[model samples]
Target: MLIFTNMKWQQALKDYKLYLKIERGLSKNSIDNYSRDVDKLIKYLDENKSSNLPINITSEIIQQFIYETSKTINARSQSRLISGLRSFFDYLIFEDYRASNPLELIESPKIGRKLPDTLSEEEIDQLINAVDLSKPQGERNRAILETLYGCGLRVSELINLKLSDLFFDEGFIKVTGKGDKQRFVPIVDITQKYINIYKNEVRNHLKIQPGFEDILFLNRRGKQLTRAMIFTITKQLAEKIGLKKSISPHTFRHSFATHLLENKADLRSIQLMLGHESITTTEIYVHLDKSHLSRALKEFHPRK
Candidate 1:
């Protein structure tokens, strides 16, 4: 085997990060996740007193590391970690730092496809209505929930939304999704109405902070809202409505897709609106509303 000399784990990781960023065009969050996966293996090797170089690390050691870590994480996380390590090793191989990837033959643990939790249309209405209109943040909260459900936006995309992205005249708002890819999602009249009310009434009065002037959603202090804040807002609203199911910002997203599927929206259209990279990801909504599938069969099948 052709072995490259003096390739340390740290240097390999640094180079791999650059590769993911520039060559792969990965977003910062994605790059961090990929790097963190490899970091776990490096931590294990150091603690175990293994002196394996990046080019010289054997599959046995990698397998043992995975085995040890798998004890602490669930199957889904373990699968992701294994996939991440595989990508890292593949990068090393691509750079000719090693002749083969150590994780090449390792199998990921079997995991069932986890169904996403969704709120019913009535539940959604209750949750939104539960917000106290008397409070100064009420309009903003209402608009936030409306936008989340209306656009099926990921929490990251919601928080990062800007004034420049809004195109109400065109009936579409630009969304920057995972990997910084931008797509236009249609906004309904009601959602646009609430957003306009919040923008004109609540957001207009804030002593806007510097550099956050264009950010659509802002904290009371006139800064960008954190992802945690969005989760907290959803959790509070869910509790206020006596909702039993555990929910997050993602629940609204799932509900958005589920409700659409239940109402006979095409999977491909949902995929595009949800900004999913693959139709397979969007197909989960089909599973969420199996009755829709049954109804379709009854309506269109030759034998039915």
Candidate 2:
């Protein structure tokens, strides 16, 4: 017989951190990442309950979370949430906080297959040239577009990016993605050149908002730029170029993934770069890009 002790969700999660470190021999960053995942679970539990507590969590409660998340998040994400719950229960069992892990038999959501869209080298160049370099933000816009294609950042991550995150000296940037997870993504010399040009020639001239002093991108008002602004900018540029494809700041992110996969970049490495918690999410883009096969059809198909 085991006696479950810890009642407070925060306290239990904290103790789980120690177990992941001292017992599991994981690095500090890894332990912290796992903790954040568990925290999200607790938040879900608390918000849905009138009197939330660790003891109140049931299999059905967790299942409800999976269903709700599947509506908004992808299958890859639902899998990560399940993994987080599995870890939480593992910690409970290790600490004797529970007699058994509730997640032992729970199944994960099945993410159906879907391919990602990518731009060809010519298409990418066309998009970059679409920026009106004569304008004040031209250099900045060009660089931002390059960084998006180069770094594969979500709009939120790109907008929330900070000057301090740049590690040009080491050829990488410390990116903070969903759940505040940090990962260092490598930057090539070409991306570095463009970004540095914008930083020196453009971002330096902004009026500079007080609290957002270190933010990388800013509006004319000196405040940080929002994701919507980036979307609007991209949409306008796409129309100006007479392009018919529907795209946004996120298209660049997808393009980044497709380009990398087409070039034969490793799935594990791509997953790391994309800030995904599981490789299953990254694998969706592997054959999904289909650049090689699709181009052949366009080039040789008699219907063309």
lDDT of 1 by residue, 99-134 (tens): 998888999999998999989999999999999989
Best by lDDT: 1
Off by over 4 Å in 1: 1-7
Residue ranges of candidate 2 with Cα displaced over 4 Å: 1-111, 289-304
What TM-score against the true fold does each predicted structure earn? 0.92, 0.63
Ten-residue stretch with the least lDDT total in model 1: 1-10
RMSD vs true structure, all candidates: 2.7, 7.4
TM-score of candidate 1 to 2 decimals:
0.92
The models' CA-based lDDT, in order, is 0.91, 0.79
How much is the lDDT of residue 296 in candidate 2? 62
